[model samples]
Target: MAGTSDPLTPRAKLAVTAGKAVAAASRAAGRGSGSVIGGRVALKLDPDLLARLAQNLDVTLVSATNGKTTTTRLIAEALKAAGPVVSNALGANMPAGITSALAGGSESKFGVIEVDEKYLAGVARDTDPKCIALLNLSRDQLDRAAETRMLAENWREGLAGTKAVIVANCDDPLVVWAASSSPNVIWVAAGQMWKDDAWSCPSCGGVMQRPGDDWFCGECGFRRPTPSWVLSGDHVLDPHGSAWPIHLQLPGRANKANAASSAAVAAVFGVPPQVALERMYQVQAVAGRYDVVQFQERDLRLLLAKNPAGWLETFSLIDPPPTPVILSVNARGADGTDTSWLWDVDYTRLTGHPIFVLGDRKLDLAVRLEVANQHFQVCDSLDQAVQMCPPGRIEVIANYTAFQDLRRRVGN
Candidate 1:
């Protein structure tokens, strides 16, 4: 069992020990990360294991449709600069995975946790975090995770009276509405590129009016809150109107927005913006996303775009025109069961790049690209897809499971 200042109950100690054994066995067997499965067994023995493990730690919960893992990693890095920090850095956001991580890092002074949007309320209740960062919400894995508005309302209802300071994205109307219930909130103008989900106000189900960058509901009075932290082009301005130059090893504007959010959350832990951003610069990738893998005589830079909003951001991160791009999609359990979300993205953005599509849902993606008047070659595997392109450096963008599949294949 992990060493903690607060002594664990006899059952809790036994549970933690059993869980560690299972996780070690799992890793040795080449099964998986083993965090979730280990935590599950621990929780079965002691249902309150997560809460017990997190009780003595200063925890920060990060929830979003996208960028949760990366933001969590950034906050952890900033917090690590201050002192010891713990995090589930392997893209696991559920209670089970979180518990396993907490148990492993029992003596860490701070904890940065990534939580799924649907499970934010429950995890927050158990962790009693110092703060909760709410990133933008969009339609993702809709089959299992309810609609965006419904998830927002869940956040609203579940977090009505809690004391966790909410660090929320003001540009996202849904996030604004959800965080509205919490009085102690630091609104951040982290830009939202996907507006389809926010055009309808979550407040009164009325039309939302967006005149330029500002947004307000026409029918209801709910409007965008004034932000204390803003992410302007290549810069982040703090509340005092001082600009912090955003220079990150991670590519793309979306990651810059993530950095801005992380700086805000780190401030609660007494970390200054300059210090936070300076430490965050050390993070080059989250999990395997944005990491380059050498495969079949080509350098394939991996990018994970799990939804329409994610795809929009991914298009900006890849190499320029004439560079070959490989796109993959899967409707596995981790990904949503429905492939209908493929139609939401505008595939025409890849018009100039030599595009190759593969995965379990390659046919579905092919049909969507056809409808968008985009040219794409449908192949059966990553190797086949790369062979279709004459590539020295190729780009590969995949959704949840598909990204993991290729990450494993290349041993990256």
Candidate 2:
């Protein structure tokens, strides 16, 4: 509010006040997480609360089927060097969550929001963001998000009229197709590790060719766009062909790609490359992602993999066999009631490793692992599972609900 000169309408002001009151009461009563109910009340009072609050703010929106949270955290961390920055860092990435974050950070002129893939179009249109980062498109929440191609088409239609500069991942064909029509686009080859969801060309419905890291559609002649910014091994290359070293505490090549995307986005906002990389290195974790917690004398490194594509990336980051790992799965509402996605993951990667299956869907995972000829033991108690592992650091890979439960047990 302090950064903007635009005055809020009386009705909008009343809506904001009522929303804040409801949020306060909800927190005091301990009935909800206090993230969405406040925004819900505000929207109920004034249906256009989001567009009003978003006015006169420079916003960068990050949306993807995966890595949106961590990538958003990286971008927000880097952009803070410019000035005061506000973000929805809690991983509540919907209309309600976005409204709550905007209301909470009313004094900041810059906003970095992580939006859900399904709701990206509406949020982007409402916020009129300065830049939109499109990470990748993959199968996620099949019950809710209809199809990957359909989502991309929706994004293409939603962003057709926006004037914001689009920063897109060129390595992903679906992403390329979605942002191709944008008048101002900056392509970054952030590297797409999971290709199971994009085996077919989004343009001509032809079989896509993946020769090494590059991809092309032979029938339609649609290929991976030549990127302006490329993420090579341990380095990010600029348009001038100069490379800068990237060092991040977050593990795996996926995080390196996230850093590259953040650096590209930061550059568009006038933040230097070196300065962005330096700021990103200081980020230890993002919303409990890749965070180490001590549980029962064992230091457990938590990794959240909600779907097959996420599992594929997480598996590639894990250390080779002989390392003790815990695999937890759940079929809760937040975890997507359908547990069929578990079968889509390649569990043979952990064949030789000692795996302890936990969570409500442990039996389901155990059966799948058995079919894949992977040896694993079932543990009813997480404490017992930890005790079974050797001393020192242990890896814990969990889905949505299981990961949240573990985070709660670890007390942050």
| TM-score attained by model 2 | 0.97
Q: Return the number of clashes found in candidate 2.
A: 1
Off by over 4 Å in 1: 1-7
lDDT of 1 by residue, 153-191 (tens): 999998887788899999999999999999799999999
Q: What would the per-residue lDDT of candidate 2 be over residues 1-412, giving only the tens digit for each residue?
A: 2346764688888888888888889889975567688888888888888888888678999999889999999999899999878898988899987888887776776799999988999999888899999999988777777699998998998898678989999999999999987889999999887888899999989999999988999998999988999999999998888898999999999999999999999998999889999999989988888988888888899999999989999999887878889999998888888888878899998878899999998999999999999888999978889989998888899998899888887887
The lDDT of each candidate is: 0.90, 0.89
Most TM-score-accurate candidate: 1
